[model samples]
Target: MTSLTASESATLERAADAPMLAQVEQWAAVNSGTGNLAGLRTVAGLLADAFAALPGEVRLVAPDSVENVDAAGHVKTIQRGDHLHLRVRPEAPVQLLLTGHMDTVFAADHPFQSLRWLEDGVLNGPGTADMKAGISVILAALGALEASPFAARVGYDVMINSDEETGSHASAALIAELAQGKTAALTYEPALPDGTLAGARPGSGNFSILIHGRSAHAGRNPEEGRNALIAAADLALRLNALKSAELKVNPAKIDGGGPNNVVPDQAILRVNMRPSTPDAMAAAETALRDAVAAVSHEHDVHCHLHGNFNRPPKPLDPAATRLFELVRDCGAALGLPPIGWNATGGVCDGNNIAACGIPVVDTMGPRGGAIHSSDEFLIVDSLAERAQLSALTMMRIAERGTV
Candidate 1:
């Protein structure tokens, strides 16, 4: 483990706890759900202002156009809020990428707003842990890094996207672009309450299959009409049956059923899949396509499949393992608890970065739990602790000239 210099230790010690919690409270109060474009724009403006304090050029880049298939089998374009991009010291010897998201799972109408103290050190609110606190940690760490003597040796790009909660469809291109040419990356996704991190992650995909059939009166000419709903149900069962040790399949929802008097002409099946390896991911995709084709042929219905596995599996390769070791050493040097990591079924922006062949420690954020629910909470003390950890990790990397 690399030891911290006097100047570096003093800089890390200055990570203020009160200011971090205050920033979390302020940012959590706003509802910036993925679908809430207005709220996301407001939050983006606020984050841009906050990150601007660092020495960088900040810009709000418009999100790319994304398409979604509705229940009626119609494709519609989705509008996502602008994302914030900041670049500092691009010409430095070491280039790093820092990423976070401004969006949460709670919609604008959700009642999970406002902060409350669940205990002396636990603060509960929406986006407080899932990553508003993580963002604050990133800001604090970067602020400290900028104040250090080795600041000029490290160049970094900050990407706080607006569509991460909904699969990062709009900001995916930008993510790939920013990840290019960076030596390493840090994504401020909250750690578990016990400070355990997510190591390798499975590849995930969401598919919406729209089936079209002929509609007829149920009592009159039912035999002449094809039922799309039945086909969709059969497909759902088939997908569920595909689950095994290597792949996880979930038939989440079905849409497009009509009154009991008539045979439904259109139906949609929404499914999610997580494959543990690249080969497993390929097999899953092929199995889904083949199943859909068979169902369509057997039921004599036209089927359209939308969406693909955008996040590929993130294996614990040598580079990623080395980066995790660096984080572990840095955490220990800061007097924090031992950092442990395990494979997770969850996928995040870090998966994309890893796909670019760049090593990333995704969960370098504050300790928190119950993310994506109304009970989401953040551990108050983890704010400064994680900031010091990240700051020290970055400083070490900058000093060594590699991850």
Candidate 2:
């Protein structure tokens, strides 16, 4: 085992003493799913109160307005809960961004709401690893950092948003705003169960294409009516065909359809696209517009598209590689395994942070797996392990000026 310095040992001890498991249980018990506004509110308040323990100003920023395209092809406004932002030592020489999300994929009405021991050292529940436990990790690591002498050398901003599970639509601007002018960033998205990190994530775009056409009784005027459902089906197929090595496509659903007796007049196609690079992302959007245009002209229907690429592909640029090297060095100093990373399909606020041109090692949380399912679990012993890793990493960055 690598020997730790006196300060490192003491700081890690403080981080280890955080009530992470207890906090996870408390938060996982609350169903703060993206669509559950009330639940998001409750959890955001709880997080604000907890993070307030740090030396900083804690504020709950309201989510920006989000629009949804209905089955009837109408765009309507949707509500989301506030996001928690905490600022500490803002004027310090070394500034950092630390981020996580309060939202989970499990909804308030979801049945996978109870926490249970899956084994001696494993606990299963919603948001246990993705990422209430991650939030706990952030709190613990910062608490330790604040106690150490190195605290004076570093400044940080913590953002726990309410809508990450849904592509961070309501909080995208906030992520970009906080990411600006940071020395480095650490996002507490859980690591792989074996402790490997995610690197070079692909960008994601979600869109709802509303199609409208003339309606008529199927038997009486089938030829006279322009079927919106058929046009939507054509659009879905066209969108799917746009898939390639750089871009992956999924036409997930069509929101509108009526009686078999009539030619349906309105349908909203929900599709998602993932592009591995910025060029791919741009080309994908252009191909999409072309497909939509072809479908509209061929089927004689009106199509309205709504959405943008919420998360841009995060490439391992030179700056990002340097940050990863720093984190790996910190892990080595702790006598942990040689930390390494690989590209993942999953996207998070890390993508947004990376887009701001700051170096970031996003998967700094504990070893956990089966996220977004009833089987989600966080390794009990990993709480202290990861917090220590985070605390030391930040301390080292503070000791120096950059990653």
Cα miss at 29, model 1 (Å)? 1.1
Please list the C-alpha lDDT of all candidates, in the order they appear. 0.92, 0.92
Candidate 1: tens digits of C-alpha lDDT, residues 1-403: 6467798788798665427888888888999999998899888888988988899899999999999998677899999999999999999999999999999999999988889999999999999998999999989999998888879999999999999988999999999999999989999999999999999999899999999999999999998889999999999999999999989999999998889999999999999999998999999999999999999999999999999998988998999999999999888887788999999989999998998999999999899998988889999889999999988889889999998
Q: Cα RMSD (Å) between model 1 and the true structure?
A: 1.2
Poorest lDDT segment (10 consecutive residues) of candidate 1: 10-19
Model 2 per-residue lDDT tens digits across residues 1-403: 2567899999999999999999999998998989998898889889988998999899999899998877667788989989999999889999999999999998878899899999998999999999999999999999999999999999999999988988888899998999889999999999999899999999999999988888898998888888998999999999999889999999999988799988988888999999999999999999999999999999999998898898999999999998888788888888888899999998999999999999998899888999988999999899999999999989988987888
Error of 2 at 72 (Å): 3.0
Clashing pairs in 1: none
Pairs of colliding residues, candidate 2:
none
Q: How accurate is candidate 1 locally (lDDT)?
A: 0.92
